[model samples]
Target: MPQSNINRRTVLAGGAAVAGVSVMTAGITSGAAAAPATGLLSGGRTPGAVIPPSDPRYEVLITGINKRFVAHPEHIKMIRSAHDAEDAVRRAFRQGKRVSVRSGGHCVADFTCNPEVEVILDFSEMNAVEYDYRRRAFVVEAGARLYNVYEALYKGWGVTLPGGICHSVGIGGHVAGGGYGLLSRAHGLVVDHLLAVEVVVVDARGRVRTVIATRHEDDPNRDLWWAHTGGGGGNFGLITRYWFRSPGATGSDPGKQLVNPPKRVIAHSFDVPWSKLTEAKFTRIMKNVGSWHEHNSGPESPYRHLSSLFNVNSRAHGRLSLYTQIDADIPDARRLLDDYLAAVMAGVGIKPVATTKPSGELAAMPGFLEPRELPWLAAARMVGAPDPVGANPEARVGLKSAYYKKNFTDHQVATFWKYLSDPTLTGVDSTLVVLSFGGRINSVAEEATSSAQRSSVIKVIFQNIWAFEKDDDRFMRWIRAFYEDTYQHTKGVPAIDDVTDGCYINYPDMDLADPQYNTSGVPWYTLCYKDNYPRLQRVKRRWDPSDFFRHSMSVRPRN
Candidate 1:
């Protein structure tokens, strides 16, 4: 992952599809969604600020990171606090206008910016990160972004949340979506440390009030907390803030409440030229990467200190890359990284040597490309893999994700090789990214949190990034065909099986709901929630009986 400059355009791009209402509480890593605010009180009971379509900020606010989706809402309600959100939600309910809640606008689906959405409750104004002495936990507002949250937590208390890797992703949908990133393997999902969430909800009687949900079993709102653990965003209500304190954290020290990532980390990257990579060699390389994770990604594995992303770029790119980071605190960290690289390059016969030999910092670190140590905070700022989605701000991208419980089968490897190596599919950027999963993430029981795929060791993303609207169809066709071919045996969807656990809600995809695409009869909800769908539906029925907050793939209340 390279540290790329995050500009305003990238900052405003939030993933659109998340839980329709909101959720609070729970440790969820991996999937990106929103974070909750304080349940105890609204900051100053701030008033909702209205921005009409006529306003200059209207177009900017209405447009999300993905240009694919846009809304012509009558107005936008910018919430500075939970009370503001309550007012906005209540107004929308009374006015009979459909509303969408937006945090970071980089969503994969059109959850926010869409034609059907009449109004958007923009939580971007509610961005705030602080340790609440009264709550005895860190409070990350729904509007908070990943980079700011990391800088605030690390700078203020030297603590961190194991959440999204993208710098500009919002906390609103990200926290509830059970998002994870580089640090997740070492700590756990960000939701794992969640203590409580504050959300604004419209009751059965059309009355909107702010509710505080906690993980306390006896708490009346415990179900709300459970739903948000990994349930995605906007399902239950509009989450205002999230309180995070480690599972067994005690005493008054907020600094001790969250996990402290390594002060520094060793970053590594390697490139395999397409020209030299034969089909046989490619299969071996991909298999080794998966098998390595299958072997080393366990709750107790010392390799948990490491995380990597293998970017299987399209043939047009000429080279494939793997980005990695390992906590430098562990003994034999360098050797461990070396062995990991050895495994990836084992049978491939691609020996990487420094062009001009070594000197200075390069002398001690022996490996391909640049492998060096840097402050952990700096590492969090780097962007990779999905970076293509945000690279141009104007880039249109399509993505599909799955959690792999086991290594890549020979057939799966062959499919990946076919799409990425095919000469005919050109003119667009596509990447089959395999992100390392497992480690402490698998330690949690599947039922412990809303994030159900706990046993998975690999998270796969099939992505295509293109610049022109005219090229959307072609790029989409390529990505879809590639994905379907990879899962041909599973009826074009990653159903619950020995190798594939299912899809991730954070990387929401509507194709799974379309019969034409998902011939597999496995309902879209089952793919994301697995057996947890039933419980989530019950929570939706209880908390959002009116179904006021809804979106594609939102939890449908069980009869």
Candidate 2:
């Protein structure tokens, strides 16, 4: 990993207090049912069930996966069962209060963890995953962590569900948002195999009902299952449990899902120097690797044994780094790797320093989720095919990308480079990362699951991480300018525009919704959902018409 020149002392010099709060207890108190001016219950609750401010559990409930956004809600309701969730929603709705439901607290925008929230329907107490060998499936509680689920499946049935990279992320939001990870390239998305969901629905009359939606194609509520695939969380009703159909199964068989865990999974990292390479060289490498992946995707392809991610980070400090990952066994892996490297070096030229290691399945999982830890301050935009232009002598920059398709045209490649090399941008990190997107991912259709970017050949993430929070305006301006410049460069260019699908939801950025940033009027959902937005909106209307569950970019109910 490239080290940042910005010192730790410099980051804290601004004295911005990290926002956080304490977890309230589970019990309720008297007069807590009164609705605040915001229409949400700001306080007052049933006696004997309230967790007062004096309780010890108060502190733990407020922190989240990011620890970036934290504020105490008026009240915290710890739900032990699906019934508790249903009841909580009903109370909040009856009081005309805005409610936030929290699963793992991984929400970057503080949707469920926000201080403005009056009622928090927390599911942390419901972490449980049960395997039914006879049915060849697992019923997982919403609060279950990815790691816990993995542990449970492997221990009880020697099986696992394909899901996100982080073990700490809650299944509720993860699956509701169309979870994907290492197994994705092989097993498809987590939702692709979803069998059923147990949700707490609040009717217009303020009555609570527990409803179940299954994968049965003939089920009337099949659309509910589709919405969970990628519709995102807080839109549909609160899902307490998810049932997953075991992959590669013939009727009921627990052992079917447990492929002999790879005896040895090896990883290799290649870091190329930005100073030594020209813009043309960088573009060539991106195009070559991208094309290779697109051509070799599907059940076939000579390099099917390998899964790789390529990224470039460009900064205003004149730093550039390109990184790639190849997943394969150590023996023949080197040869397969060389082929990729050669393709990258075809037109442009740069020799990269490579590092290789063998890791167990558990240890290797984190590698796929690597980008999550990078200091992210701004929202991200997804780029399909990127072309690297010559280095901008005036600006320090970094760039990175993930290739889903095998290749892009030279014109597409050039257009990408032009955007990154633009001047006038400042206070941003010079970095870029290109991740590998396709292998088994492409085999699934856009509608097959809620994750709609399946047609994209590349998933480009543009990020800027700087040292000072005070530099927020300048940094944001720089990144937004870069994004617009990139979009402008590709406008009307068939090869670039036609193939340049929008952005990723996980890399959420509110700027995409701003008319100033998104001149195309393409709402963020269009970038993330495409045709699936309308369906998601329908689900949102059906489950949360009052929009009780919402955030900046959450699915909105259509009129």
Candidate 3:
């Protein structure tokens, strides 16, 4: 793979070293609730599919999204429904084995593919999307990928759930971690529309049962539902299904209740040659983005209809680019696009930014490369395609993330430029991507859900993709150094301070929890969940008193 075109899979599901696995035998139970031979759970028929180490598909099932950390579970059980999931959990508990759940197989960290994971409950077969009359919302099974969810919703009722751009991302973990996407600025987060969830949880007595929790104010299990929203997955239980109905939608008619899919989408790509970029120029471009998003990120801002990603590739990559999209059905979309582009380059110390149609050719000048318009579904598919480099078994990647309340300081900007332009940093494909944030999402109260990051204007993702295991140390050291330096003001971590609002939980970096790396004097949970951590701990205690499901970054039960 070319170093410039990094794989999205690697970007999303990087790798980490395996931590020691802990064993627990107190929760064991095998007599009455033993999983039936028919693979039937309490409510549904599961396939009872088991792929042992000898099975040919075991290797494929064990390969994570990044193809970096390949787990070797004792066995893999396929879950077809909530009942199946519960059965799998019961068996794992009875066997005194640690259980790990895999939905889309895209966890960025080693949460599900760790050494402690003995039994793997694979949800790949449980994918199903349909409207549920009783729930008055769309019922999405945990195994469903974002692409399946989008297609099902759009085709079934001309509605859409604004989610991540990756089609292959599983809804199980995505929604649980407070999923966001291109339209998040306009529609808020996917969690904003979450109404209920079906989870298979182990009780205090070690009994496995499925619980359906909803957002209804009087629902006895309301906290369970709230914990699923941005609480991050694998904390309380294994999520089996999610019910989505936009908040305030009273009608049971799925078509009329949910947000309508965009009528059309306009996709634009801007390519800036490295020769045209300087430290000052780069700083100006980023400043424009930071200030623009901060000022315009409101429920009523016209710019909320726009979302763009500024991908700053290392100077070694020889170019920088912007991927932009907008709902064309909005009024004055053309003018909005043009004005936004103009504003980004307004003070970048560059002249005559060129514009042209996408001609399948490299741009000789710094300007918009290709401007193509497509129907909503087509555009969505194009955006979510995985990068081929991710399939390379030899490739390994590492990721780190942060949310910014405002523009980067001069020092931060200079640090990025210095690292990117460094002559010594070579071979690794590194990039700093700035995603547009804060719009309708900020309209919601931070305390309303587990996702407490409502004030940030921009979210940053730091990535380093390399082709050799030998380069792991070098790549990790480079990325960590970059991240530490970027947040040096906060003691090498994005603590809840003036410039940073903590980190995104979905990124799941264990380094933030290690005192050796995080000298910020702030607990990693504070950086990931902020004030919501206490509430999460309470819910964790209530729902998972035995601490059944957990990982390095999973929420801890109250002491």
lDDT of 1 by residue, 1-559 (tens): 1121222112211111122333332222223223332232322444666999778888887777677778899999888666567667877899899989898787878888878889998877666676766456777778887888888788888899988777767888888988788888888888889988887887788878767777877676788888999999979999887878889888978789899889899987666777888899999999999999999999988899899877777777666777778999999999999899889989888755332321101111235366888889876665422344554667677889999988888889999989999898774357888888899989999888999989999999998777789988888898889889899999998879999999999898889899988999999999999999999999999889988899887888777
Evaluation by TM-score, superior candidate among 2 and 3: 3
Clashes of 1: 41
Best first by TM-score, ranked: 1, 3, 2
Q: Write the per-residue lDDT of candidate 2 for residues 373-409, one digit (tens) a residue.
A: 2110100001111111111112222221222333655
- What tens digits encode model 3's per-residue C-alpha lDDT throughout 1-559? 1011111111101000011111111111222211221211222343558999999988878867665566778999987756567668888888788888888877768888887788888887767676655445776778888887788788868888889877767889999999998889899999999987877888789988777777877676889989998999999998877878898887657687677867897777776666888778988887887777777777778888889877677877666667788888899887888888888888786653333322111122223344566898987876565433334455576889999887788888888898887877784358887898888889999999999999887899887777777778898899999999988888888778777899999888889989888997899999999999999999999989999898879898998
TM-score, per-candidate, Cα-based: 0.89, 0.74, 0.88
Worst 10 residues of 1 by lDDT: 8-17
Cα lDDT over the full model 1:
0.78
Give me the runs in candidate 1 sitting further than 4 Å from their true place.
1-48, 352-370, 384-388
Residue 393, model 2, lDDT: 15
**Every candidate's lDDT:** 0.78, 0.56, 0.76
Q: State the displacement of the C-alpha of residue 361, model 1, in Å, after optimal TM-score superposition.
A: 26
Best by lDDT: 1
Worst 10 residues of 3 by lDDT: 12-21
lDDT of 3: 0.76
